[model samples]
Target chain A: MAYIPSMDLVPGVLKGDTRAVARLLSRAENGNEEGRPALEEIFKRAGRAHVVGITGVPGSGKSTLVAKLTAAIRASGRKVAIIAVDPSSPYSGGSILGDRIRMGELVGDKGVYVRSMATRGALGGLARGTLEAVDIVDAAGYDMVLIETVGVGQDEVDVARASHTTVVVSAPGLGDDIQAIKAGVLEIADIHVVSKCDKPDADRTISDLKNMLVLSLGLQPHVPAPLDVGARKAARWQVPVVPTSSVNDKGIEELLKEIDRHGRSLKESGEIVERQAAIAERRLVKASEEMLRDKLEERRGELSVLLKELAARRVSPHYAARKLLTESGFGGDK
Target chain B: MSVAQTKADRIRVIVAKVGLDGHDRGVKIVARTLRDAGMDVIYTGLHRTPEEVVEAAVQEDADVIGISILSGAHMTVFPKLLKLLKARGADDIKVMGGGVIPDEDVVKLKKMGVAEILLQDTPPAAIVDSVRRIVAERGAR
Candidate 1:
């Protein structure tokens, strides 16, 4: 069969066609220019699904928990989709997308769609076009969209910003340097999931996370914008540390309840609007940066003369950059 | 995108084992070898139904499906897989397999739309080269 053009598949995608959704995601990961318009159309239809991001240290049992969570979510009669990511070999550029190994439970369940993605050289624990992949699933009318990123350390916080609610999972033995993880990763969690709670020594990890949350709560002050003061008038949200034994299927239902509650709270507090704006700003900045990079690539030939000057130190790096931006109609100031 | 990945040379392959085969070592080896050759491989661990494997390939948009069966179900597995692929409008995603099959079954398998059948004795490098070739052929199609 000849491949279907992306634009021609837009209606299928909008109609929740699995094949179309899958095809579009592949194109996005490949960074195909032909898929751009289809993605644009698909993204405009997004924003209905609650985008939850799951990130934690490797071996934190992220994939297992995601599998359990998706199953529980389905039992509640909600259609859920998972974008599970695993790392690509830095050497081979190929990856063993083994999240499917753990997610095997969700297979053949029509209500739950799972797509295992290779990080494909995209960093920060996500695959290239991760957000776009989320949007594609979201546009397909999945009630809940879960993005499980490659296990991340302190600085891989991009998933937090890209998602409406971020769940940071940590196994009992993973976080030895609590302070280092706290400084970067802990604060990003809307919910802290202590997975592998069935194992011994789980109590200490739970207590430690709760203590960290309590300790951090008082130190970070909320700066309400003029418009946000009204939204902030709602009761301040507390980050909950939920411990779960995904292996035992214990606490799975309770965690789902908490997620539901959090969703309602976001809307009732009118903070969903604020979150939407912040997310929009982030997306705008990211998309603009993406465009700039593409433009830079296109103008590489034009940049050779400037590159020679740069190599000779005749023109400062800042001057050449500003000149190029201005000449490219980006309105960079002189 | 990560600067490490070379565009235009990557392929996504799903390496699966269907039926009651607990022997996954061979499939895992094939998966790893393909990965080393710079093809993304999704390993559908032991004992998947034909439904699960076909759905996986379509959902992952894989360029090829490599099934390793040691349970003597190649006759049933390959035809069913190809049928499901055709039914889902995904026969474009080529299918191949290998296992303890008699030589006669290999010829019949190929005649029934199975792209390539690797015997157990095939070299690891040959396995990678064949998959790479299959993916390139799909691209040309």
Candidate 2:
């Protein structure tokens, strides 16, 4: 069967058709070529939603925190979409996405849309299709888009590059405070949340995070280099460590406020535009790489012949690669 | 909006447990089996209501909704789910189920729009084959 892009998909997505939105995301996740035009149509309508990324170690209650945050965002009369990226099973290429279980409360709410995406071997603790899915949700007019990573510690920093505000989640009693410092999650955090703060050692965890933040800030405040020459010099932002216990419903309101405060700071510092530009750059680079990969695969027979020649010591590996590049029209000059 | 046609890609399935059933060992295994068969399976975790399950099926555009209920609430959960799916115009989604269901209840559930019911003894490969057959039947329609 010839693959035909769904004719109504772009229109249906704009009309807030949930099924169409899901279909579009599936196409992107599977790397379907037909999804490109739909994405192009959706991209112009994006950039309105605030994309927040939540990442933490497994069992840090990241899903619970996301559920609470979604509720809080909904309470403010804004629509929210959540993309929970789960690790895929290497044996089957399938994922047991249980994040939605913790987020059960938000299931029937029309204002909330939750999707579970598989990492599909992208290896950066996020599904390769996440950015496109976010764009689909954004175009569908959601007010906030929350991306919860697979939370494999340092590898989750990809979310920092993809989101406007990256909230790093942690919990007490797991030694995550030290782990966070060691894993450098503290460096990428716009807001650090210590979930399950009702535990006996919650206070100690909170204090540990506070001390580490202070030490890190004093030693060397990690900041991305400004992309633009006229970027505003804003005040030094303090990474607030908020203690939250979802069981007790404690500190959720404070956490929301801190997120808002960080958003405001980004806007005031003119960093939001810079961040969006960086995200766009990343997307373009990824798309170009994917196209190059596809082209190489289309020429797999020739590439295999070149590889065999190199393996037989008939030609240098670099020379074969340059020849292939030139033949593929990518080399600047022959 | 026009009905979205099924792509030639892998079939998508949503595996869920409704009501207070916390025993998900059976459903998790089924989900893995379907996924290994090259299907995209979305497991909606545990303790979901019929409404939540139907909502997920609709939002996911799943070709199948496989429920694993061990709480013996098959009569309540299955019928309610059928009614909800009908009400939401999601009749195209095929519903299959398993996990400790009585023989009599399985017959009744089939009459109430449940497509297939696997018993506890059904092998994982059989479950995968059943899903493929159901998806193929649906696509043919």
Candidate 3:
């Protein structure tokens, strides 16, 4: 062993010790290698800042839009952190992480921090490491965190869910009415932006999105899904939509102002606390699930034996399932 | 153990993207390759502010930080990443970069703390080697 230290350095992160935050993020992103244990430490010190998620179809200029917004936010004198989530190629297990390329101009600003994350096959469309990445930035004292997801479809929704406010970006004439109508994006956007106004169809796309939002909002509630506990707390409010373009630098500032407005609204209305609570509740559940998952993986050999025994009629399938679940902590009352 | 002990044992590296480049294939590939090679690679993905990447480097206790860029944004992104890295006590981390860097800019990047600039077509082995050598030189310090 090379004598790597434990992840206890996370406490220093809150004090603005950049070294400690970096080590913790490294552990969190790299599955904690020598620093993996820092995750729990990092999580405990998290929850102090606002998180914003940005997603859009590919080439909708999501990254460019984010760049301008973050830069504007920084100029206003707040520390900003960006997490660019890109799709990992199934075949190569690689991601281009090209989103950061759009915001290159902001790369050197002391008030800004940007990180690229591969989705790493996490089912939720966001990278499993993303939550920890956000936490690291949050604990390190960033006033705002912006997460940009590599847009494909529904997975982008999963990425945006982690943010306090989520912006869905779209471009005119790219996918047109069909994309605008997709169930994935319309439902999740707290705000929608029609990017690339320099193009001719930009205004038309904005019109189409507005029309679609009207139709969808009017007909929705059939699902009656429990309101996102946070959404329920902020009841009577609808997410907003705006337009932007990186090419001409249009509407970028307004988009950020909207985010700030939404943040304040949630706070003034007492929904901010509720939203944080909801986020905490969900994160705990996820942590437990991950813990259980690890246990099952650890017991793979015994699980196989149990399965073999069940197949040979040595035990009932139901009993085997129970035993396996119990051994994996699903049986615990706690 | 003391902070010095941690620094000695762990070699931190940051892999970042600089400027209006939305193509991250090279960044991801390099981050994973570096991680598997047993160094801590902190990747700041997409449209990162240069300040953010440098902050990550200093905070992560990186020994060698690499930037991946493809957009013409290199002019803006690289200078910023370098300037902030120097200001934040991260000048110690041997800086290197890759992407569609112009031949003319390579000289400037190296002069500005980028000890190495891997061309777009640089072999993975070379990247791994450059990082390893950088770490080996600085690891025991």
The number of the candidate with the highest DockQ is: 1
- Which is the better candidate, 1 or 2, if ranked by lDDT? 1
TM-score (C-alpha) between model 3 and the true structure: 0.72
CAPRI classification of candidate 3 = incorrect
Tens digits of per-residue lDDT for model 1, A1-334: 6768989888987888888888888888777788899999988989999989899988888988998999989999999999998888888777898888887768888888888888766667777778889999999889999999998878787786677787888888655765568777766777889988988878989999999877766555563422232224223678888999977798888888878887888898777787788678767876787677667766777888999999999999999999999989898994
DockQ order of candidates, top first = 1, 2, 3
Measured by lDDT, the strongest candidate is 1
Name the regions of candidate 3 deviating beyond 4 angstroms: A1-8, A33-45, A89-94, A176-181, A226-235, A300-323, A332-334, B1-141
Query: What is the DockQ for all candidates, taken in turn?
Result: 0.53, 0.32, 0.15
lDDT of 1 at B76: 94
**Higher-scoring candidate on lDDT, 2 or 3:** 2
B60-120 in candidate 1: lDDT tens per residue? 8888999999999889999999999999888989998987899999999999999999999
**Of 1 and 3, the candidate ranking higher by TM-score:** 1
Docking class of 1: medium
Worst 10 residues of 2 chain A by lDDT: A225-234
TM-score of each: 0.90, 0.88, 0.72
Supply fnat for every model shown.
Answer: 0.57, 0.38, 0.17
